[model samples]
Target: MKIYSLINEFSSLDPCVFTLGIFDGVHIGHQKIIKNLILRSRKKYCSVLLTFHPHPKEILNTNKKFFYLNTLSERIYNLKKTGIEHLIVHPFTTNFSKLRTKDFLKKILHPKSKIRKIITGYDSIIGKNRDSSYEELKKISHKYGIKVYKVNPYKFQKKIVSSTHIRESLLLGNIQWANRALGYFYTLSGNVIEGKGIGKMINFPTANLQIDSKKLIPKQGVYAVKINYLNNMYLGMLNIGINPTLEKENRKIKIEVHIFDFFENIYGKKIDILMIRIIREEKKFNSIQELKKQICMDKINIQKFFSCEKKIR
Candidate 1:
C-alpha cells in the first residue's frame, strides 16, 4: 500500500472510496468496515484509508491520559494487511480539530479530489465537537456528489466488538476474552532492558522490557505468553507487577518475561509478547523461597496449558 503524509499528496485522479478513523487495534468492527470498503472499491474506485497521527485525543485532551492499543507503527502494520490501496496519515493539530463538518468534507470530497464514496462505522462522528452524525455527513457530501455508507456494528457473543471493550478486558486481566474480541492475541512490543537479577537467583532469569509509555498495559499479573524475538517464537511466562517479595518499598510496575528452554544475551533486543492467559495476580510472598515455589507451580501450569493447546490444535 502507498502511504501519504497529507491528503493533498494523494494526487490520484481516479475516483476513490475512502474511510477515515484512528482504527486503534484494528479490531473486528474496524475490519468489517474495511471489508465493505474494499468490496465497494473493487470496480472503479481505489480504496483509501485516512487516519491521524499522534492521535487526536492526545492534542485535544491535554489533561486526560489516554492509552492506545497499538502504536502508530503497529497501526500502520495492521492496516496494511487489509489490502487498502492508499493510506493518508494526516497531521492532527488543534487547528485541524476546529474544522466544521462541511469544511472537512470539502477538503476531501471536493470535485478535484474525486472521492466517489465514503464508508464509515455506524457510530462515527467528526468535525468540531464531533457533532456530525451520519445523516449530517450524507447531507453535506451530497453537495459534492459523494455517497456515504455506514457499516452496521459488528458483534461477538451478542456484544459489540470495540477497542474500548478490548481495553477494558485487558485491564481486568481477561486475556482470553480480549483475544476473542481482538481476533488475535494481544501483543506488547518493547526492548529488553537490564534488571535487578532477582529472577536469576531463583533460576528463572527474565528479560525486562521497556515498553512505550503510550501503549496500554494489561492488568498486573503473571501470564502465559508467547515471545517473538528476531522473527522466532518461544513459549514463555510474563509478569507485570512490582516485586513485592523482593522489595519492601519499591512500587513501580515491572514487565519481565521468562522464556522457557532458552538462554541468550538479549539485553538490548526488541521482542513482542503475545499474552495468552492470566496465571495469577501479583502477591507478596513472605520469602524468596516461597515466591520461587509459587513460580515453579505457575510454570508447570503454563507448560500443561500449552501442551493441551497443541493437542487441541
Candidate 2:
C-alpha cells in the first residue's frame, strides 16, 4: 500500500474507489466499508482507500483529550493488511475543517484524488457544521458525476459494530467481547524499558513496557495476555497500574508483564501484548510478601485461562 500525506501527491494511474473517514479502530464497521470498497474497486479495475490523519475530532474539538486505539503508524499497518493499494492520509487542519461539503468534494475528492466511486460506512458524516449525511452525499455525488456507496451496517450479537462500542468495552475490561467484534485480539505494542525491577525482587522478573502515552489504555488491572517477542509467543501475566502495593514512598503508574517460564534480557526490544482476558483489578497489598502471594494467584489463574502448563509456549 502506498501512503501519501497530501491529496495533491496521490497519483494513481488506475481509477480509484475511496472511503473517507478517521477510521480510529478500523473496527468491524470500518471493515464493512473497506471490504465493499475493495470489491467495488476490483470490479472497476481501480486502486482504493482514502483516509485522514489526526481524526476530525482532534482537529475540530480542542478541549477534549484525544484517545486512539492504535497510533497512526499502527493504524496504517493494520489497514494495509486488508490489501488496499492506494492509501491517502491527508493531514487534517483548520483550513480542511472549514471547507464546505461541496467545495471539499470538488476540490479534493473529485479533482485531486480522481475518485470514481466513494464508499463509506453508513454512519459517516462530513462537511463544515456536520451538515453532510448519506442522503445528502448521494445528492452531491450526482451533481459531480461521482458514484457514492454507503455500506450496510455491521453488527455483532445484534448490535452494530463501532469504534465507540469497542472503546467502551476495552475501558470496561471486556477484552473478549471487544476482540470478538474486532475479529482479532486487542493488541498493544510498545518498547520494553528498564524499570525498578520490582517484579524481579518479588521473584517474577517482568519486562516493563512504555506504551504510547497518547493511546488509550485499557482498564488498570492484571490481564491474561500473549506476549510476542522475537518471533516467539509467550503466555504473559500483565499488570497495568500504579503498583500501589510495591511502592512505598514513590508514586507512578507502570505497565509490567511477567512472561511465564521465560527469562531473557528484553529491555529496549519491542513487545506486542495481545490481551486475552482480564485476570483481576489492580490493588494494594500490605507488604512485598502479600504482593508476591497475589501474583502467584494471578499466575495460577492465567494458567487455567490459557489451559497451558506452567511453562510459556
Candidate 3:
C-alpha cells in the first residue's frame, strides 16, 4: 500500500472509496469495515483508508496517557496486510481536533482523498469538538454527492469487539480472550538489547527487548508467547516484571523472553513477541531457588498450552 503522510499527494485523483477510523487493534469490528472497503474499492476501482496518529483522545486530552493497541508502524503494517491500496495517516493535534464536522469532511476527508464513498460505523465521529455523527454524515453526503456506507457494529464472544475492550482485557492480563477479539495474537515489537545478564545468572538466559517506555505493556506477568526472530517462530516464555525476587533496585520493569530449545546471542536483533496466554502473575519468590522452580513450571505450562493449541488447529 502507498502511505501518504499528507493528502496533497493524491489531490489530483478522482474520489476514492475509503473508510476512516482509529482502527486500534484492527480488531474484528475494524476488520469488517476494512473488508467492506476492499470489496467496495474493487467494484469502484479505488481503494483507500484514512486513519490518525496520536489518536484523537491523545490530542484532545494532553493530560491523559495515550494508550493504543498498535504502534504507528504496526498499525500501518497491519493495514497494508489487508490489501489496502492507499493509506492516509494524518497527524492528530489540538488544532486539527478543532475542525468542525463539516470542515473535516470537506477540507480533510473529501478534498484530500476526494473520497467517493465513506464507509464508517454508526458510532464513529470526527471533526472539531467531536461534533460529527452518523446523522450529520448522512446529511453531508446528500449535499456533497458522496456515498456513505455505515457498517453495523460487530460482537465477539457475546460482547462488542472494540479497542477499549481489548485494552481492558490486556490490562487485566487476559490474553486468550483479547486475542479472540483481535483475530490474532497481541504482539509487542521492538529491538533486542543487552541487559545485565541476570537471566544467565539464574540459568534461564533471555533476550531483553528494548521498547518505547510509553508503550502500554500488558499487566505484569509471565506469559506463553511466540517470538519471531528473523523469519522463524519460536515458542517462548516471556516475563514482564520489576524483578522483585532478585531485589533489583533499578525499579525499571524488564521484558525478558526465554526461547525454548534455543541458545544463541540475539542481542541487537529486532523481534516481535506475540502474547498467547498469561501463565501467571508476577510475584516475588522467597529465594533464587524458589524463583527457579517457578520458572520450570512456567515452561512446562507453556509447552502444554502450545501443544494443545497446535492439536486443536
Number of the top lDDT candidate: 1
Candidate 3 lDDT over 141-167, as tens digits, reads 767677889888888778888898899
Better of 2 and 3 by TM-score: 3
Ranking by TM-score: 1, 3, 2
Q: For residues 1-313, write the lDDT of model 1, one tens digit per residue.
A: 9999997898777888989988889998998999999999998899999988777778889998889999989999999999999999999899998888767877776667778889998776567846545666788688778888989988888889888899899999998888988878999999999999887889999999999999999999999999999999999999999988897788888999999999898999999999999999999999899999999999999999999999999
Q: Which runs in model 2 stand beyond 4 Å of their true positions?
A: 109-113, 248-251, 308-313
Which wins on lDDT, candidate 1 or candidate 2?
1
- How do the candidates rank by lDDT, highest first? 1, 3, 2
Clashes of each: 0, 0, 1
In terms of TM-score, which candidate is strongest?
1
Angstrom error of the Cα, residue 123, model 2: value is 2.0
Worst 10 residues of 2 by lDDT: 105-114
Compared to the true structure, candidate 3 yields what TM-score?
A: 0.94
TM-score of candidate 1 on Cα atoms, chains taken together: 0.96
Tell me the lDDT of candidate 2.
Answer: 0.81
lDDT of 3: 0.83
Candidate 2 RMSD to the real structure: 2.6
Cα lDDT, all candidates: 0.90, 0.81, 0.83
lDDT (tens digit, per residue) of candidate 2 on 153-185: 888988888888888899999998899888788
| Cand. 1 Cα-lDDT | 0.90
Tell me how far the alpha carbon of residue 117 in candidate 2 is from the true structure, in angstroms, after superposition: 1.7
